[model samples]
Target: MGKTYLYLLIAVAFEVFGTSCLQASQQLTRLWPSLGIVVGFGGAFFFFMQVLKELPLGITYALWSGLGIILVSISGWVVFGQKLDLAALLGIALIIAGIAVINLFSISSPH
Candidate 1:
């Protein structure tokens, strides 16, 4: 159980890192950044796949997708200065609640 969440965290970190490099790749107009994007996304996906191997599919996907949403929203605000309106904030909150529910009450998990 701990190991599964650790892998999920790694996947989220890779995804966040990859997303942060989006601007660099967008502006560089070179081959290196493109390659980096490819490899970064590939690595992130690999971690995500590994996460799914030991967890229930529904719970795993929910957590993965929810974490991605929350982190990406934070990244946008931090890196892009995008304001989160009340509605947007609420939406993110809902996603977080959904993840918490899965963690606390999911009967299907091996944990």
Candidate 2:
């Protein structure tokens, strides 16, 4: 169970890295960034599959995508000079709260 969460964390990291590289890819026109996208997303999916082995699909995807959204949003702001309005910030906060609720209370979560 602990290993499953570790894998999920890794998967989220890889996915965030892939999404950042996707921006650097310039719509897939560059070579290295494009390769990063391929490798990063591939690694993310691989680790995500490992996570699914121990956790329910719904729970796994929720954690995976939720964390991904938060991290990727921050990455965009920092790395890409993107702006988040108040509404967007509130949405992000809500997502964080949702993830916390799932981790703390969901029965489907791995212990």
Candidate 3:
């Protein structure tokens, strides 16, 4: 359902926020970023729980974590000046392909 995917998108956004804050936290030394970690992940789990009501765990996790990795990787590159070499780019491409396969073809994924 549309609501299910919306919840999943919110969850992924919070997770990406949490992960981005984690990098900015500097090993948890920075105060604001550390708090962001708590709030971001907290919101992530809260909304993710809402999603669990409609979707199976394995499929949800695959989509959640897959999108998270891709977004976080981009955030790291753009916000943190991190590099994505050829191998890393290839890996990310593979991740995208895997997610596409799951969403487009896997019977378990929600329509």
Candidate 4:
């Protein structure tokens, strides 16, 4: 179960990295950043598959996508000078809370 969460975290990390690279890819015109997209997304899905082996798809995808959204938003701000207004910040906080609720209360979560 612990290992499953680890895999999920790794998957999220790779997904965040891939999305960052995607931004850097400049519409797929670059070479190295494009490669980073491939490797990062590939690694993300691989680890995600490992996670699915132990956890339900709904729970896994919720955490994966929720955290990915939050992290990618942060990356966009930090790496790309993007800004998040008040509503966006509120939405992100809500997403974090939702993931916490799922992990803390969901029966489908791995023990």
Q: What local distance difference test score does each model get?
A: 0.80, 0.94, 0.95, 0.95
Work out the TM-score per prediction.
0.85, 0.97, 0.96, 0.97
Q: Report the C-alpha lDDT of model 1 over 26-85, residue by residue, as the tens digit.
A: 765867766766776778899899988898778777787789888888887998787899
- Higher-ranked by TM-score: 1 or 2: 2
How close is each model in CA RMSD to the real structure? 2.1, 0.8, 0.8, 0.7
Question: Residue by residue across 1-111, what tens digits does model 4's lDDT show?
Answer: 788889999999999999999999999999999999999999999999999899989999999999999999999999999999999999999999999999889887866
Q: What is the lDDT ranking, best to worst?
A: 4, 3, 2, 1
Which ranges in model 2 have alpha carbons more than 4 Å from their true place?
none
Please count the clashing residue pairs in each candidate, in the order shown: 0, 0, 0, 0
Query: Is candidate 2 or 3 superior in lDDT?
Result: 3
Q: After superposition, how far is residue 98 of candidate 2 from its true place, in Å?
A: 0.7
Best by TM-score: 4
In candidate 3, stretches whose alpha carbon ends up further than 4 angstroms from where it belongs are none
lDDT-wise, the better of 2 and 4 is 4
Q: Write down the TM-score for model 3.
A: 0.96
